[model samples]
Target chain A: MAYLDHAATTPMLPAALDAYATAARAIGNPSSLHAAGRSARRMVEESRERIAAVIGARPSEVIFTGGGTEADNLATKGVFWARRDADPGRRRVVVSAVEHHAVLDAVGWLGRHEGAEVTYLPVDGTGRVDPAGFAELVRAHGDETAVVSVQWANNEVGTVQPIAELAALAAGAGIPFHTDAVQAVGQVPVDFAGSGVAALTLTGHKLGGPVGVGALVLGRDVACTPLLHGGGQERDVRSGTLDTPGVVAFAVAVETTVRAREQYAERVAALRDELVRRVLAAVPDAIHNGDAEHRLPGNAHFSFPGCEGDALLLLLDAKGIYCSTGSACSAGVAQPSHVLLAMGADDARARSSLRFSLGHDSTEADLDALLAALPGAVERARRAGAWKTPR
Target chain B: MSGGVDSAVAAARAKDAGHDVTGVHLALARNPQTYRTGARGCCTLEDSRDARRAADVIGIPFYVWDMADEFHASVVDDFVDEYAAGRTPNPCLRCNEKIKFAAVLDRAVALGFDAVVTGHHARLGADGLLRRSVDLAKDQSYVLAVLTRAQLDRAVFPLGDSTKERVRAEAAERGLAVADKPDSHDICFIADGDTRGFLEGRLGSAPGDIVDGRTGARLGTHNGAYGYTIGQRKGLNLRVPAEDGRPRYVLSITPVTNTVTVGPREDLEVDTVTATRPIWHEASASVRCDVQLRAHGEVVPASVTVAAGELTARLETPARGVAAGQAIVAYRPDPGGDIVLGSATITAGTRESAHA
Candidate 1:
């Protein structure tokens, strides 16, 4: 089986699994004020410190949440609401056009339900946000801006953003910047303090940790509202009893993935490059997307001409090669990729795009299996034509 | 799959038959839950979820394919156009013809699936003919008559032999949630059961004269001529009775003149009906067939003549409520039941009064 959808979620590392089993066997919620609770709290704190150290943030700034989505919701809504409350005039939300649905939908909710003026910063042909363009938008909004958000790298296209430049510019503009680093954190060098962003969202499952455990590395001085109000945990930004086992497993995965970042990226990038090169070689018209030099080491995205992505994906799935389409959909009709469209791709190009991401488990054999199935699948999909109703 | 008890049981039966199966719910609406849902709806989020649930129980992969764009173009747009052209369109038949059999089946075959399976209540005979389902009351061969032989070749109806009650019972036995879910009723698109309100929103109001067809006496006015169908006795709101003190019935709607012709009930009866856009299951120049006018309305003996693009059927006895733009499906009455031959959309009709 060739699993190329690592950006969706990777298999948990052995160390994380062991940590989870060990932590789960222990008793007591971290919120309880007893001996067992103290032990649990210690484990949670140690996990937080370990995660913070690896991601370049203070231990106190690590606010654990359910997962990447919750962390993103906390960052977008939490900061936007807090900033709007502090200054009623701050009603504009500026985010990049390529952000994940977590940040995009949350910011959209603010626009629709909370009466905020939402603006999406566009991307270039490579799906990268121009630092200058974003800074200009933030400056123009000025006092009306509640928050600015741009991801470290796009999940679908893997185009890395000029994060430090954009975040520092937003910081200079006196508006908090939030980066959804869910796809960036183990794939690239992520530093909370160095990036100059008020909030960064990272989840475990995307790397190798247990699902349903993630953290929002919020700034100490940043005032953010809590999404869930209960037990007043996680600096009052995120509430609910911490998943002691899940947190332990998540921290181990983060520490391990971060520690091996350079070597892992080198190996996975080589595999990804081979897959991209061979796929293009076999299917000559397949156009590779994203910035080659400035992308996640494990990511390669492409759009095959005259082929619908869903049909191709299903054909590959039949042969046990799992990948993902960059395009979202309503009902069964594939909607063009918002990121690709923002990057100036037409509907046809966006509809034909697919993403294949490598990880710690990806190998040459996996790529071999993919190449074997791809050529025929592309041929069949092309012959099918773009899912138009057969008259 | 519609995510109903019949479909759930169909999926279960297909899985049990050992063919590799994947269940899909065709999403025919642009927006989910926008239409008022009763027992029946074209596409609802709840139905999609229920289908997925049944798939989980049956251990087959499930997906909801968004065919809304195709549905809008083929079914929804045609519906409005037919009404605007003063014809009563059969959206259900159009859906079966274009959506399930064409758009969806084409995609499935391209994606390497041998056939597209559904929970439709119709049987495929061993001799490669489309036959009425064992559960005759639930037989949907009338709507399916629009499907060509190519569609029937790759279509599977797992609940063909089972009654609706038996399908529901099997679903309950299999622990499916939609076992007790009511069978869909009325038109799926018209959620509130208010066809006029739905039509007014789309066609817009066009005031027109409602006149007596025979005597040429102006009866009343109508908001829009398209809002009335042939043989419709309600929604005209005309106060005066006919010449013989008989009730009034809408005999014809002429959108060009924006005039609705109402007369005695006998005027609504038609002996010869001319239908266009013919699709034949098996080609024949002429045949003695059982003709169904409205869906689940009735089947009457008719002699049908088939041409390249048209079908003309002369009913043994004139049938009432025969309207243009509706489907006139031809079927051969088998010893066991009836076999669906093909169908055409009604384009013209010779009323009993004209014949007399």
Candidate 2:
């Protein structure tokens, strides 16, 4: 059976797997002072240097984390808490509407339980946040703003936000800016220095690395309070005995994915473009979501009028074609997506939307299976209820 | 199909009859995820999952229909409006009438299923007559009185011939998860068995007067009238004791005037009731049948007269506290027990509060 749910989780690349296997066979804790430990510590630093070179960051800036979620949480809450503590008046957090739940939820928790006011900067239909709108919000709140977080590219609809423009605005105000670049790393050009964001989040798994290992790039000037306090690892921000094997594998995966970035993007984008074209031609009313030009090469999202996304997902699953309704985190809840709602979509359109993401193993055959299964599935789903007339 | 035990068994029995039977569970939850049964609900996610598991055990396919928006718009909203209008509405009757037999059945028929099935403890004869199930303790036809002929045409009940014990035994024999699942007894939506709390949360507490029926004197401050239904005895939080220090029952709820009337237990009995949304299984025949006002109420001998799509039932013995919103199911004696004819909503009640 074809596994099309790569956005949910991708198979590890051969290089990453080799790195993990090699590290897993090796002995010693990087923190220990013994010879074995010194060897492990050297391997970790070397892997860190390789990843730093690819992302255009210094080795000291990369703080290793558990995964994308932990990295996003640290970037959001850690930055907000640190800024708020330094200036008691900094009680506001600005976030883009299309942010992942890892950031959206962390910011929401700060607003709800920690007494920090949160303002969501609206996105256009393509899910891109206007830098001017974000600048206006920061200008209104000024120094009272704790932090601003926006994804470099949306994980679902894949609209690549103008991170450089947004960073410049936040930099002028001296408010720390963080961007979740998990989906953007291998799909587009993401240079830490060029982007000008203080902190950036990247996960290994999205780029064909092992799960449970990621890094948060923090500029030398930025100060972030740790969410989890323990043995003061990762420069006193994230504390845990580091997984040496996972780190090596993650770094290996990052370097390999980055090196093959241009070719892979072209191949995946061709497949995604065909998928969008075939889906639209077959299901005429299918509305493609996200930025037509600036979206990630592998992301294709569409809203089919008068059909529930769950129904479509199940039908596709029945034919052994695996995709997703939206973000996998909020799949079970039968509510229209909050991201779609914030993008000015009504409940019906939000409920009707589906996300089909391509990755390392994606092929033309996978798109053919989806194209063949969609028309019948949408028709049957529409027949099951009194469909809402399309807007 | 009625959602009682017998009809559920009947549906399963038919499925076991080697026909292409597809077992279905309707999603009546306004929000199925948060759908709770009052304190002990049966339409819960756990229950729906259990029902799906049962279908899986039977080697059949199951699906959860998104009937939330419709359930809220139809049954739940109707129930709130009924209470707000100073009338008691049988939510079970509304659910069965709309959700199970009509909405569920409608969807089932569209899915190309031969018929919709339930566990209703009522039987349909070869001549298409509605008869009570053999089980005397678990007859649910009282709540299923609103099923129309069109709905009944595609309806099937499996447990109509067996008692509740036999039904459980069959489910146990089949190793269904619901084999030992306790029967639900209260309103499903009220979590934590707090009806008043559910009402208060949904309908904000608008403090009002609890007036004495006798002297027309203002008794004490009470929460909104919607919190109290007819025949309720406790949670009145009354200030003064009755003349004889007897427990008071809620005699009426007036939403317009926003008043709750409380009186002695004697004010609870009623003799006559008028019903709207009447449905009959037999083609307009005069038949001597038993009537039950509530789910657990004893079958009372009654004379039912129909006029202008309304059913007026005059019981042989005056039943006390016949609230306006309860279901009135008609039953006829058969070898099994009483077969259900149809049901209606209690539109009016004759109270013994004439002295007031």
Candidate 3:
């Protein structure tokens, strides 16, 4: 199958795989005080420095965690907790409506179980959060606010949010700003120093690094209370036995993916434009789901009315051309994409959206395969959606 | 033509009978995602796709007319309102009456279809009267009781003469993907296995009191009385224990008072019921027949009387737990077995078990 769900995960690069294999051969936990442990610890520190260098963050700022989900939770809840502790009354959290469930569900938990209040700032139809509206909210609730978190780019609709502008508003309030830049790290230009955000999250799986490893870059001045307290790993913020192989692999992937991003993006964007053109020519009135200009170069989302996204996806899958309904995470739930709905897509449009994401590995042949299957797929899918009702 | 199993099969049969037929499946889900969530039923994406695929296999043109907004306005909203009013609503009957035969079928005729076909288990008489299907196990007359004659005139049911098993066999023979598809039993939208969860999710928590039916003593706190139906037994979460330790059954729900009354199972039984908006399958008036309250409910002998405003049914053997907001589908026996006389919504019923 021509896999197009790069938003979910990607194949690890040869360099990353070699880095992991080399690190895996070494023995000893980094925490132990013995010479073997010290040797392992050196490799981990070296990996951290490589990761920090590419993201323009200091070595001390990189805190390794389980993966994207953990990084998102720590950035969202840990920062909220830290801010709340610094000023006991700073209990409100501002998050964008288009956040991944890792961030969205954590904020929901805070609102539901914790005493903290959460305000979901609405996004425009393009899935871009209005920085002005966020500023208005921050100014209005400046007293109770703990932090403002908006993803760097949506995993589904792929609209890149104006994080620099959004973070500037939160920064003015002296509130920590965190962005889950999991999708944006390699695909788009990202600099921790340039973005001026207090903290940022990036995962390995989405950018050709092996799964189960990610990092949260905490700015020098940012003080986040540790979510996991143990042997004081990752600057005592996230304490766990380091996965040296995974960390090394992650650094290699980030370095290589970011370096080649420009050329890769140009190629994929051309193929994506063609995919959209041919899809529209085949299925007229098929609506694109996000802002055409602001969307990810690799992402092409369209809502084919009179057809269910799931059914269409399955049909495409049968043809060995795999895609997704909206996001891979919520594939089986059968609810209209909350992200699409928040972006002002009506129920029909939300139900009809199919996301086709590309990556460095994507090629013209993959696009051709998708285009070949799409026209007949849309027609059959629409026919299948029909219900014979009584007159 | 109602877009259902019986009608779908009838359309195929009619086509097989060498008649020109077009199959149409109405887009009745306000959002197909609601019903498709966790694979609910024939309302699912898979099912709709299956129906369309069957039409395609039969070499017929198929179309899906958007009736979602109308379905929500007519069926889903009414269902929530009825539950809020302390009554149990049958959404299937409402869909059959309001969307299937009435609304989409009207649109089908407008689009130049000779008639609408469904997979309903009810049969039509030689003189063109609606009757119960030959297969009693698959009879769906109860849900179709509310469909009007004018609506029925353009309706067809191919599965009426065949049993569900036969339908499956035929589906298998034709290589139809959904020929052996499992019959959908629950409400399509509420796939979380909790109607209360759906209500709570949509309507934010409304604090209410759960009280003992006899003493009026507060038994527990309920999120909303609107979430509880007349005969619901679960989710009471009562702090007070019954005398016999049996779970309490819902006896009444007073939305105005915001109170849910709970009592022993015996308190849920009802003997008599009055229904409104009756439609006859064979004639304009009433007759003696068997009434089934629920989809799987057994038929009980009853003398049915109908007027322009309402229909009164007095069971020969009093029924039990006959809650309000249920459809009263009547069935009369003929050469085909049982024919549907039509149906109405139950407005009131006796408080105790008439069967007991």
Candidate 4:
């Protein structure tokens, strides 16, 4: 089987697996003061320092959580609550429209339940948030805006945002900015300190570690409220018993992937470009989505004019080629990609798109398998035309 | 699969028979949260999970085809409209005709699948004729009688030979999780089983008079004429008692007049039923057959004639509660009455005594 959906989740690296197994054999909670506790604490501290060093953050700033979603919620909701509590005037949140549900839904909850007024910063046709638009929004409601969030890279289309410029605007306005860098750390160059963002989110599974482990990198001065309250841990901002094995595995995967990122990106990006080229050649009407230049190296997205992405994905699945529609499904019914819709595509175009993300393990053979099955799947799906019922 | 034991077993049996089977659950409810709250209906999230698990155990590819919009437009809307027109419609029959066989089948065939396999307790004889299930107690051929020959040709039912008990036993033997799940009863879409409340929500109360058929005296007031069905004997709450002190049954509902006429139970009997929009598996000018008027209603011997796209059937013995908008499905006269010959939508029914 050819698995081209690494952006969803990739397989764990052998090194990370070994680190997890080794840590699992150890006993005691890091909070317990006994010898076993101290040993566990040492392991946890070492893993924190390794992750901090690799991601260009100080050891004290790295706050471990259950996973990327928790980190994102902690960053979005935590920061919003903290800012609003500090000043009653700060009741607005500014975020890009194309953020993943992890960030979008959190901010949406803030808007609905909390009194946070949200301003969705629109992206261009290629899914990039323009810096000028951010500047205008800041110039208008800078004082009321509690936080600004734009992802480092979109998971669906792979369009890298102007995070540095957006962060600079937020800083000038004296507002805290957060970026969901879960899809960027292992796929691109992510330096927490260099990016100038107040907080960043990264998960382990997406970069070849175990699931259910991730971290939030926060600036020293950023005051954030805690989402979880129990057993005061992680500098009193996040409270929970740390998963020692998971933290060790996550750190090992982060270090290993970051060290090999440059070479890995080049190899996978070349394969992705070829896959895109051959796919477009085979199906002439297929449209490639996302920024041509400012995209993640291993990401390739396309829209087949008259095809339903779900039907095409199933057809490909039948042929042993796995990919994604890159959209949320409610009760197995595909909802049009909000990212694509935000990029100015119509509902049909949004529903017609598919995402194929290559990983460190991708090869020419995988791309060959996809190309062999794609043309037939597209033709059959177009013929099906079951996306919209004729009245 | 419907996330029930029968469909799950049907999927397994089809796979066991060496046909490439794909399990599919239909998302029929617009808002699925309102459906099957505690496993009494289909299309709920729990049911979807059950179906997915069953598919996993059966070892086949599974998908959920969203037919919510089509179902609302075709079955739900048609049901409300029929009721508004003073007719008692069977929504399950309409769903089988418009959704399962037409909309879903068309899409399946277009997607390269030759047929759709459902768990309806019905059979297709070797001659490709629609037949009642051997398990007569669980027979669904009445509801399925609406399918055309073309639709029936592309449909497969795998649980016709076995009883519901046998199907449940097979499910347990196969280690299926839904072996003990209770069978879904009443209308699946009507969550509380209150058809009156459901209709009232859609067609708001148009207060009307309930009059006695013989005396022409107003007996009571009804909130809406559509809430009362022909042959309904309960919930009348009549203010006046008949001179003979006999219980009254709903005889007719006239929407235009906004009136419901109630009389003795014998007045609800009809010997002649006029129907339209006839769908036939085997068309005939005139034939002696047994006709079923509603989903589980008893069949009566009738002489059925077809002409000008209309069907007129005269029953040998009068049938009570033969409501308009219910399907009149003709079957071969028993001892071989299991074979479905044709079906039509009842437009009107009249008592021979009234004409005499």
Candidate 5:
């Protein structure tokens, strides 16, 4: 199979797999204080240090959680709750329009059930939140704003946000800033201290690590509530027994991907650009989504004018090629992408878009297969008619 | 596959027939578990799992395609709109025609599938016609009649030749757990068996008069004309009885005037049923057919004619309780065959004595 859906989850690096296998054989709970426990504790701490060093975070700031969603929930709810407790009037949650459901839904829950006033900072046509637009929202409700969350990059459109500038704007307003860097870390430069954000989220699977492991790099000065409260590990922000094997593998994956990011981006981005070129060459009117210069090296999203993305995805899947559609179906009903809507595209365009993200294992050969299969799929899907949604 | 025994056995039969099959259980509702919808509703999470298990036992790929939006638009909304106009609409017929055959089948074909397969108890003849299921009790050709030539040409009903009893038996032999799963009944969208409440919630209450169709005298009042069906005997809450001491039955409902006309049992019988939206299997011409009104109701012999975009049928024997918006499926009844020839929606009907 030509697997170009790496942004969804890439294959685990072989070295990371080896690290997990080795750690799995060792039996010790990192929480316990026995000699065997101390050995596991050492492995967890060393992994923490390795991840922190690569991401430019303090080892103490990296709080491991089950995955990216958990880390995101902790950041939004924990920090928002803490900040609200510090001052009850600080109930405004400013999140970007293009955030993944992790941050979007968390902030939404706070607004709905917790009485938070949410101001969704809108993005430009290319799905980018200009620093000025974000700044205006924060300033308009600066005193009342408890938290500001703008993702490092959008997962769907692959438009990298101006995170440092946006984070600095929130900081200037004395508000807690959290960026979900899950998709950005391995593909871009993400430094907690360098970006000046209060906390950030990263997951292992997206960066070629094992699943069920991620971290929330939080500043020591930030007082946040806990999502889980059993072990009080990782500075008490999150509470769960450390998955030693997962942590070790995650650490290895993060270090390898981040270190190799520069050369990797150049190689993969060149191929992705060529893919965009060839796909457009095959289907003349196909529109590329997101800002061309500002997207991730591995990301190539397009909107075929008359095709249903899900139908196209499944059609290509039958031909041994894999990708993702921005639109997600619930009960056989496909909903147009909110990100594309925020980008000012109409509903049909939003529903027609698909994402093809390259990874470390992706090659020109994968591109060739996709290019060869795409035109026929698009033609068939168009003939199928834009997924007949309910009137 | 719907995770039921019929679909499960049908999938097994298709696979056994040396055809590559992918079992799919359509998620017809967004949140099936939230409603106390019972086994009748197709969208329950349990049903999806059952389909998955059947696929596993049969060693075929399975998927739950969410078609809730299409169903809601095509079938659910149509049910509400038809009732609001004081007509009894068959949601099953709408689902089969619009969602299952047109929408879902079209997508399957476009995705490279040669045919759309379902467990509906109907036969796809080699002549490209749909016939009745072998099991008359389990026959579903009434709803299947709405499908056109294109849909039937690319459709596969694997459970047609076999009886429901044998299908269940095959399912048991195949180790499919839903072998004894109860058949889905009634309108699937109307979960909880509260059709009145469901319609009330959507159309709301519109008070109107319930009058005797013969005397034109008001017999009682009704909460909403939309809630009443043709030939309904009970629940009218009439304050007075007929002069002949016989019970009253709803003869017709006029939505524009919000009036329901109730009369003696004789008024309910109609010898001639004129229907619109004439859909033909082939050409439009006069032919003798066994016409079925309800999906499980009786089929009476009728001579049907098609012309000027309308279909008119004269029943050999007067039939009662025929309602507008219900499908009138015509079946070609030969000595050894019952094939669905065509169908139309009942728009108007007259009593046998009216013309006499």
Candidate 6:
């Protein structure tokens, strides 16, 4: 089977798997102080340091959580509560419209129940947030704003944002900025300290590690409240028993992926470009989405006119080719991609789009498999067209 | 699949028959929590999960097809409109006609599937004629009669030959989790089974007088004319007793006049049922047949005539409480009246004595 949906979650690296298995055989919680516990604790701290060194953060700044969603929730809610507690007047949150549901829903909850006035900054047609528009918002409501969030890269369209510039604007206004860098760490160069963001979120599974483990990289001076309150772990910002095996596996994956990112990016980006060229040639009306120059290396998203993405996905699945529609499904109902809608596509165009993301193991043979199956699938899906309620 | 014993067993049987069967559960509810409150309704999240689990045990791929838009436009809206017109419409018939057969079947065929296999207790014979299930208590041929020959040609109902008890036994034997799940009854979309309250929320209160049919005297006041159905004997709430001191049943509801007419129960009997928009498997100028007025209503012998897309059935023995908006389904003459001849939407029903 050809797996082209790596952006959703890539396969685990072999070294990371070995690390997880080796750690799993050992026993004792990192929180315990006995000899076995100290051994486990050493492994956890070393993993934290390794992740910190690679991401350009201090060891204390890397607070491990359950996963990317948890890290995003911790950063968004935690930073908002901390800022609001510091100054009661700080009740406004500024976020980009193209953020994944992890940050979007967390901020949405705060707005719905916590009396937060949210300002959703719009993106350009390429799904990139403009620093100038954000600068204007900061100048207008700088004092009242508790936090600012803009993702480093969009998961759906793979459009990389101007995070350093946006972070500077938020810093100038004295508001903490957070970026959900879950999709960026191993694909592009991510330097936590150099990016100048107060906090950032990264997960393990998206990179080549085990699931259910991730870290929130917060600056030393960033005062953030805790989302979880038990066991006083991870410097009191996150409080769960450390997942030692997952953490070790995550660190191993991070180090290996980051070290080889330059070469990996070149190889996958070449394959992705070939895919985009061939698909457009095969189906002339198909529109490639996202900024050509500022996209993730392995990401290629397209909109096939007059076709429902779900129908195409199913047809391709029958041919042993797997991909995604890059939209959230609620109770099996395919919602139009908010990222595509934010990029100025209509509802039909948003629903018609599909995402094909190559990964570490992806090769030309996988692309050939997709190209072979895509034309027939598109024809069948076009025949199905959009579902119209018969009058 | 409907996440019930019959559908689960049907899917298993189809797979056992060596067809490439893929189970599909229609996500008819837009918001499932609001649609089905608990285990009482179909298309709930729990129902979808149950369907998926059954598919896993049967070892087939399963998908939930979101048909919420089509369902609302065709079934739900038509239901409210029919009531506003003072008619008691069977939403299940409308759902089968528009959604399960038309929209879903079209999509399935477009996706290269040979046919749609549903759990309805109706037989589609190899000769392409629709027939009643062997189990009369659970026969759904009346609801499915609205489907055209084209739709029925691509439809498969595997549970038609077996009784509900046998289907449940098969499900249990096959290790399906929903073997004992309660058969979904009433309207699946009406979560609480309060049809009046549901209609009242949509078409708000329009107070009208309840008048005696013979005397033309006002007997009581009703919140809305749509709330009363023909032949309803309960909840009339009449302030005055009848002259003969017998209970009065609802005879007619006139939405334009905003009035409900009540009289003796015998007045509910109608000898002729005139229906429009006939869908026929076998059409003729006239046919002697048996007609069903509503779901689970008695089958009565009738002589039916077809003309200009309308059908009029004159019952040999008059039937009681036949309402407009209900389907008039004709079947073959009955030593065994199993074959479905045709169906149409009832527009009017008149007593023979009134016409005479």
DockQ of candidate 1 (2 decimals):
0.51
Looking at model 4, residue A306 earns an lDDT score of: 93
Q: Assess candidate 3 and give its lDDT.
A: 0.79
For residues B1-356, could you state the per-residue lDDT of candidate 6 as single tens digits? 87788888888988998898878889888778733454466788778888889999999877778888889999999999999999999999998888888888888778888888888898886778788988899999999999988888888899888888888888889999998887787888888889899999999999999999999999999999999899999999999999999999999999999999999988888999999999977757699989999999999999999899899999988888989999999998533328999999999989876532
| Per-prediction interface RMSD in Å | 2.6, 5.6, 9.9, 2.0, 3.3, 1.7
> Model 5 off-target regions past 4 Å?
A328-333, A386-391, B1-3, B20-36, B44-73, B175-180, B280-284, B334-337, B353-356
lDDT of 4 by residue, A1-391 (tens): 9999999999999999999999999998999999999999999999999999999999999999999999999999999999999998899998899998999999999999999898999999999999998999999999999988899999999999989889999999999999999999988999999989999999999999999999999998999999999987898999999999999999999999999999999998999999999999999999999998898998999999999898898899988999999998777878889999999999999989999999989999998999899988898888777635733
Q: In model 5, which residue pairs have backbone atoms overlapping below 3 Å?
A: A331-B66, A331-B67, A332-B66, A332-B67, A333-B66
Better model by TM-score, 3 or 4? 4
Q: Tell me which residue pairs clash in candidate 1.
A: A331-B66, A332-B65, A332-B66, B39-B184
A320 Cα displacement, candidate 4 (Å):
0.7
lDDT of 4 by residue, B1-356 (tens): 88889999999999998998888899988888733655455788888888999999999999887778888898888888999999999989998888888887877776788988999998875678888888888999999988988898898998888899999999999999999988988888888788899999999989999999988899999999999999999999998888889999999999999999999988888999999999877756789989999887898999999889999999988989988999999999544328998999999889875633
- What stretches of model 4 exceed 4 Å from their correct place? B333-337, B353-356
| Candidate 4 colliding pairs | B334-B337
What TM-score number comes out for model 5? Answer: 0.94
How well does candidate 4 score on lDDT at residue B258? 94
Q: Which stretches of candidate 6 lie above 4 Å from their native place?
A: B34-39, B333-337, B353-356
* Cα error, candidate 1, residue B292 (Å): 2.0
Candidate 1 chain B: 10-residue stretch with minimal lDDT? B34-43
Q: How many clashes (backbone atoms < 3 Å, residues ≥3 apart in a chain or on different chains) does model 4 have?
A: 1
State the displacement of the C-alpha of residue B277, model 3, in Å, after optimal TM-score superposition. 12
Model 1 per-residue lDDT tens digits across residues A232-302: 88887778989999999999999999999999999999888899999999999999999998999989999
TM-scores, all candidates, are 0.96, 0.81, 0.60, 0.97, 0.94, 0.98
- Worst 10-residue lDDT window for candidate 1 chain A reads A326-335
- What's the lDDT for residue A349 in model 4? 95
Candidate 2 segments whose C-alpha is farther than 4 A from its true place: A1-3, A14-29, A32-46, A135-142, A327-331, A385-391, B1-69, B100-139, B149-185, B196-273, B303-307, B314-318, B349-356
Pairs with backbone N, CA or C atoms under 3 Å apart (clashes), candidate 6: none
